[model samples]
Target: MTTPLKILISGQHGQVSRELQQRLGDLGELVVLGRGQLDLSHPEQIRQQVRAVRPDLIINAAAHTAVDQAENEPELAFAINARAPGIFAEEAQALGVPLIHYSTDYVFDGRKDTPYVEDDEPNPLGVYGQSKLAGERAIREVQGQHLILRTSWVYASHGKNFLLTMQRLLQERPELRVVADQIGAPTWAGSIANSTRALIERWLAGRAGAWGTYHLSAQGETSWFGFAQAIGEHLLANGKPCAVLQAIPASAYPTPAPRPLNSRLDCSRLAREWGVTQPDWHSALRECLAEQG
Candidate 1:
């Protein structure tokens, strides 16, 4: 009998990590490490933990995700986002295991009229984006087998995400203003986790040629305002009270970090290579709400 794959996943309580824990349980022996067990900001700790776990594969789902806060804490962001993944890559390379790293769409400046492709040149607008982009470069420089999955506008039924936040704020406030100019897919964490499982299954079955960066997100795109409106409508459909969603541009909501007007990512490569296609953002959101019920 073949031994189960030992999968080491970083960021235990994160949105993606949580979903992965649920999705990947039957496929392998999952050893998930959180901040308490493995602090990613410390490179030495990362090396020590990986050496100790010595798993068959490494999936890095941890990241410093505070876009505006990253401006004030660039060092912390870089330490976790940029430096830690490089260390993980080095350790994975030494162990002769492949690494799967999650990245963000913030690497782009959002100037393109169309969706972003994998090969698009990145021009980040803030420290957070720069740090994530740096992490991507650092991992590639290690010359190891790694898959960097770049996604955008992630949310889940739980966690500190746009969906839940909207659920709360819609009840608290009579009206709320959300950015209408920025566009991207509101990808469900479950979608990402399921896709990751499929990718891993294929790789373990000897499809090593699939190792590369891919854009993984929901099928379509919408602005923050549109997303909020949909959330409110969903709540109302379910007999819940929701606030009025006001559409505003990025300029109206001046954040420390400038947001991209366009965060849409073209995910044809993932569909072509892995046969993984994401449900539309609205459909995913509906399913997530049903799960919450």
Candidate 2:
């Protein structure tokens, strides 16, 4: 009998992590570690835990995702997002296992009018972006077999994401204003997890020829305001209370960390290389909402 792949994933409560846990259960011997089990801020702990797990595949889903908060705590963010991932890469290299890491589109400064490609030069606008970018570079420098997936505007039915936050605020507030300047795909965590599984399956089938960075997000793009409007419309259509969504420029809402105006990612490379075509953002959103019910 073929042995099930031993997969070690970092992060427990994260949207992607949770979805991965549900999706990858039957395919592998899945072991998920949360902050309680493996504190990412402590690099030594990360090294220890990964060594102990000794997985055949390492999927890093944990990250310091508090964008505004990262500005004030750059060291903590770097420790978790940058330092921890490098350690994982090193461990994966030592174990001779493939490492799967998640990154963000915030690496770009949003100055370009078009969607960002994998080869695009990163110009982070905040500490959070810098830390994530640092992690990407560190993993690459380790010369380990890795697949770094850069996604954007990730959300899910659970977790502290835009979709849940908006759902709560819409019910509480009479009217809401969302930033309209920032543009990107509102990718569902479920979609990301499923695509990841497909990639792993291909790799296990000995079809993975390249191991590098790829943009994995929902197809098409929308601004924050547009996303919120869609969410509100979806909620109202489902007989749920929704607030009046008003579109406002990013300038109107000053955040601790300057957000990229254009968070759009060009996922053509992933489609061309991996033959993975992501569903539209709207369709994915509907699935997420339906799952919530």
Candidate 3:
């Protein structure tokens, strides 16, 4: 009989991690660790936990994702986003297992007018993006078997994300002004988890693609305003109070960390390489909301 795979995942409570727990249960024994069990800020703790678990695969889902907040605490961000991922790669390499790490589109400065491909030069505009870029480099430096999946505009039904926040505020407020200039795919966490499962299944079945970086996000693109407008439409369809959304330029909204005007990532590489693709942002959003209902 084939032994079930022992998968070790970090960030038990994160958006993607939560969905992964739900989606990957039938595949194997999932050892999902939260902050209390695996403090990513501590490199030794990460090493100890990975060594103790000795899993067949390691998924590093935890990240210091506070884009603006990271500016004030660069050390904490680097420790969690940069150093920890390298350590995970080291341990995974030691165990001779594949490592799957999530990255962000923020690595790009958003200067490009078109979608970003895998070979695109990363020019991070803030600390969070810089830290994430560092993490990617660290994993690559190990030269271990890894898949660095870079995603953009991640959200879920249960987590602290734009979807939940907008759902709450749209009902409570009469009008809301959302930035319209910044563009990206509002990728659902459930979609990311499902894609990850598919990728893992392919690898286990000996149909794995080239082990390297790939962009994993929903198809199509929209601004934050467009996403919020879509959310308002959903609320109105369900007979809930909806807010009046105003589209404003990115300059209108000054943030501690500047967001890219174009956060579009070319996920065609992932589709071509792994035979995996995601639903468009609108369809994915509908599926996610249906889950909440």
Candidate 4:
């Protein structure tokens, strides 16, 4: 007659939040808090909510995830991404609960044409990246029982992400112009959630896991243009509307935010440290695409 583990998860309606709740339901009692219950913008709410729940584990699935929008709303982004999670860590430490948090590949500047490891120097170019980097540093400063997973290109069936956007654009347009300069592994929210579960299971199995950062992107890499091409191919073959042509190159388009040219992440340490291996990007993408089928 063992009591079920009570896990308090933030970001009640986020992409990863939804996936994590569904996957971890069997392993614990999950209590989700939307912005109303625990807004990441307010540090006090994070502190108070974790203290009140007294959960065995705290999974912070919430984040200021809008990349381009963060540029105009630096204060809002910092409050939610940088400062709030630190407050969550403080309270989780007081309760002696493990905290699981997520980060992004934007922490890097994309100068090097190689996969970035957790130890790679972060040179964020935008407010979103800078704020997320701040949160990562703050979490490490606390030195509590915590795991920060840095991932990229997260999408799910429910959220407005790359997948849905591509689907819509391909259906509506005759031609597409995507930037090829930016590169990253397209990690599915479902896969990230499932991987988190496995990591937690291993932690509970008396495994010696490190409380540090890990590159949690999916296997393989693709430029934004290539990613869109792949999506278009899938949709066109599946009787869905798709662009007749997709042009690829960086000079073809530009944005207010200069994106990282290389979002490739090295998962060797992630595997060595967490004892987990992520599926290839194509495989994970195929699975998620089928999830909509």
Candidate 5:
């Protein structure tokens, strides 16, 4: 009898991590560590945890994801985002294990008229993006067997995301203004987890592609306004009151960290290489809501 694979996942309570826990349970014995257990801001702690786990695979689901907050705390952001990933890569390499690190579409400035592919040059508009980009580069510099998965607008039924926030606020407030200019897929955490499982299964079956960065988001795109409108529609269908949503440019909602005007990522490489695809944003949102019910 073969021993089950030992999978080490960081960020136990994150949107993606929570979904991963549900999806990947049958595949292996999971060793999941959240911020409380393994504070990612400390490089030594990261190295020690990975060394202690010495698992078959390392999935880094943790990140300092507060975009505007990162502007005030660049050191903490880089410590967790940039330095921690590098440490994981180093530890994973030492243990002869593959590392899977999540990245963000914020790495790009969102200037391109079309969707961004994997090779697009990144020009981050704020500290958050710059730090995440640094993490991507850190993993690459390690030159280990790793998959840097870049996704955007991540949400889940059970986390602090736009979907849940909109669900509540839309019912409470009479009117809400959402940014309409910025665009990206509202990728559900469950979809990301399912796709990740497919990728892992392919790799385990010896059909893996090149170990590098891949864009893993939902199929289509929409702005924040469109997403809010969809959420309102869902609430109304469920016999709940929703607010009147007003479409506004990103300028109307000034944040400390500037968001990309176009956050669409082309995920063809993931499909071509690993036969992993994603549901369209609307379809995924519907599915996520159904799961919530």
Candidate 6:
């Protein structure tokens, strides 16, 4: 008889964190640690707590994900995104366990028209992106079995993401101002969690050599305007009270944090290597909408 793997996940309140907890529930004995139990800002505490628990797998879903806010609060962003993950990695290495880290597509500048890959050179435009990139670097430098999975435009049934915001606006407002300039895959946390579980399962089956950076995103890409329109349409088609139209052009709205114009991530390597094909973004969103309702 084989023992089920013991896995630890951080940030239980966040979208990805919660999704992972639910997705990986039956696969192993899950030990969750939220900000109440662990603070990433205090790196020492991260190290100490993990050392005591000694989990077989450590999934890091905690991050400074507020893009615009990170520009003003660079120190806090760095503390959570970059510095904290380094401590987690170091402790995982000491325990001889595999650490799974999540990264963002914002690690690149919006200049490239193509989908960004794992080997691509990163030139983050804002503090949020830079901080996430720093965390990726930290994981690579650490001499441990680590997997840095880069994803983009993550949403879920819970939390205040683009889909939920649109669901509200469609009910309250007549027209929405959405930027059509940005293009990328809108990934659902539920979908990402499914993909993550498969990858971790493969890793547990004596495939630790595959421990490295890989891009895992949805299949399709669309602008925010298109995405919002689709959500509105989904609600409409499903006989829900939602009637909202979107206006394009980036000039309509501006923010302190600059987003990447191109957020499409090439996820072929992850699929080919581990047979982990992320679900289509729209399909995932529709499921999220149904589940949320």
lDDT of 1 by residue, 36-99 (tens): 9999889999999999999999999999999999999999999999999999999999999999
lDDT of 6 by residue, 1-293 (tens): 13587888989889999988888888769889998999899988898789878898899999989999999899999999999888889889988888999999999997887998889999999999999999989988897989899999898878879888888888787666789999999999999898888877777675534778999889999999889888888878878777556666766678888888899999998877788898888788878877887
Count clashing residue pairs per candidate: 0, 0, 0, 1, 0, 0
Residue 139's lDDT in candidate 3: 100
Judged by lDDT, which candidate is best?
3
Off by over 4 Å in 5: 1-3
State each model's CA lDDT, in order: 0.92, 0.93, 0.95, 0.87, 0.94, 0.87
Which 10-residue span in candidate 3 carries the lowest summed lDDT?
A: 1-10
lDDT of 3 at 196: 99
Worst 10 residues of 5 by lDDT: 1-10
lDDT accuracy of residue 60 in candidate 1: 98
Candidate 6 regions exceeding 4 Å error are none
How close is every model to the real structure, measured as TM-score? Answer: 0.97, 0.98, 0.99, 0.96, 0.98, 0.96
Worst 10 contiguous positions by lDDT, candidate 6 = 202-211
What is the full ranking by lDDT, best candidate first? 3, 5, 2, 1, 6, 4
True lDDT of residue 150, candidate 2: 97
- Residue 102 lDDT in model 3? 100
lDDT of 5 by residue, 268-287 (tens): 99899888999999999999
For residues 1-293, could you state the per-residue lDDT of candidate 2 as single tens digits?
Answer: 14598899999999999999999999869999998898999988988888888899999999999999999999999998999899999999999999999999999999999999999999999999999999999999999999999999999989899998998999899999999889999999999999999999888887774889999999998999999999898878888898888889999999899999998999998888878779999999999999998
Flag the better candidate by lDDT, 5 or 6.
Answer: 5
